[model samples]
Target: MKDGWSVFYITKNAWEEMLRDINNAQSSIYFEQYLFNDLEKGEIGKIFLEALINKAKEGVKVKLLIDSVGSTDFFFSSETVNLEEHGIDLRFHALSRKNILSNIFPNLYRDHRKVLVIDEKIGYIGGVVIGQKMEHWRDTQVRIENDFVPLLKNSFDAIWNSLEKTSARPHQYMNRHLNENAEGFLGNCPREKDKALRKEILSKISRSRKRVWITTPYFVPSRKMVRVIKKAARRNVDVR
Candidate 1:
């Protein structure tokens, strides 16, 4: 973990670590999540809000991007106004309520990535989301301290800047700290129209030496992926 990353199976621990990093923020804080309406409505939410507001007041740049559908209530709340007033650059991704057409194409676009980058040397990517129910939910989040941190910020800026109406201040982060010898990192943005994640998964499965342990709550794989798994199983590879 000192060289690669630290993994958290419990979301509460991930959140506490995030808050600790936020408390020591020196330059910037960029955060994105799929569901966020209740982020500041619960008890832990209050602490996070206070910390973010305080950092903003201290001139630390803070930006947030949340999926609109999962956190629609947040858009109409006074907390939204309060956060904006406190100098937080808040934004909602892929508006599901744009019009009748948007409703018709519910699956066309959605931002389900949960990412956070603070300053220059720390980053987090995982499925953790803030809310009262999330405290008890078993999830995985990884805290990264490698060169990958800069790339994480770059990924955040991509969607953040696309929403021109949200006042996105896009800037390049110096990627001087990437983990060149580490495994590949991939991000799939709906706007990018790419199959990087699928391709990467297939490539890894094909190259796995001993075992492949995939523990997920939900999974709907493509026919090709199923075939690959079957082939691997036939070869005596532990395909669990």
Candidate 2:
């Protein structure tokens, strides 16, 4: 809803936009997703996978991070070998026994965000994942081409380095570079303890001047979110 930016509601154009960005990546491509499998989905799922491998083979630095539970089969499949052979730095989130034990009491908190950043120039964030089933589902994705790309890149680097057990310092986020074209700040929830993202959502709802619309495959919300919604409704704001 901001000027100087074009947002694509990519239910119909999801694969096209994703493949385009991956194919055009010059220096680097980073992807993080909850689902990265194509088992039952088949051929369509292989499209992006092949594209990533191709780019990596061409010397584009490519890193992919997938949630272990969501893409377990694909992560263990023979195709993963092709990724390694092609120089793709593929990794899984929460895939190790050490991580499980470190959680104390294991929970299902997942890296559910689907993000793809290409060469620090273009980025995509959305609900769409790499799978055939998603091809027919209604979903939205945004391709950002602005100063926000660095912010997205920093986030991907942080998560990627953490999964790889590297000692990379998280880049401090700076908003001074934001201009009129910049939409707004991006809120990240890299861990369950990170509540900034949830607070941002609740704050937006609380400040809604008109209606509030939400669409999620799952409706699980925190108690604070519930209270904010109720309060918004009490003020006669349309809550849907």
* Candidate No. with top TM-score: 1
lDDT (Cα, tens digit) per residue for candidate 2, span 131-224: 7766677777888887787777777766666554554432222213233675544545444354565766888999997999998888998888
**Alpha-carbon error at 189 in model 1, in Å?**
3.0
Looking at candidate 1, what is the lDDT of residue 55?
93
lDDT (CA) for every model shown? 0.78, 0.74
Error of 2 at 220 (Å): 2.5
Q: Which stretches of candidate 2 lie over 4 Å from their true place?
A: 1-4, 8-12, 39-42, 98-107, 166-194
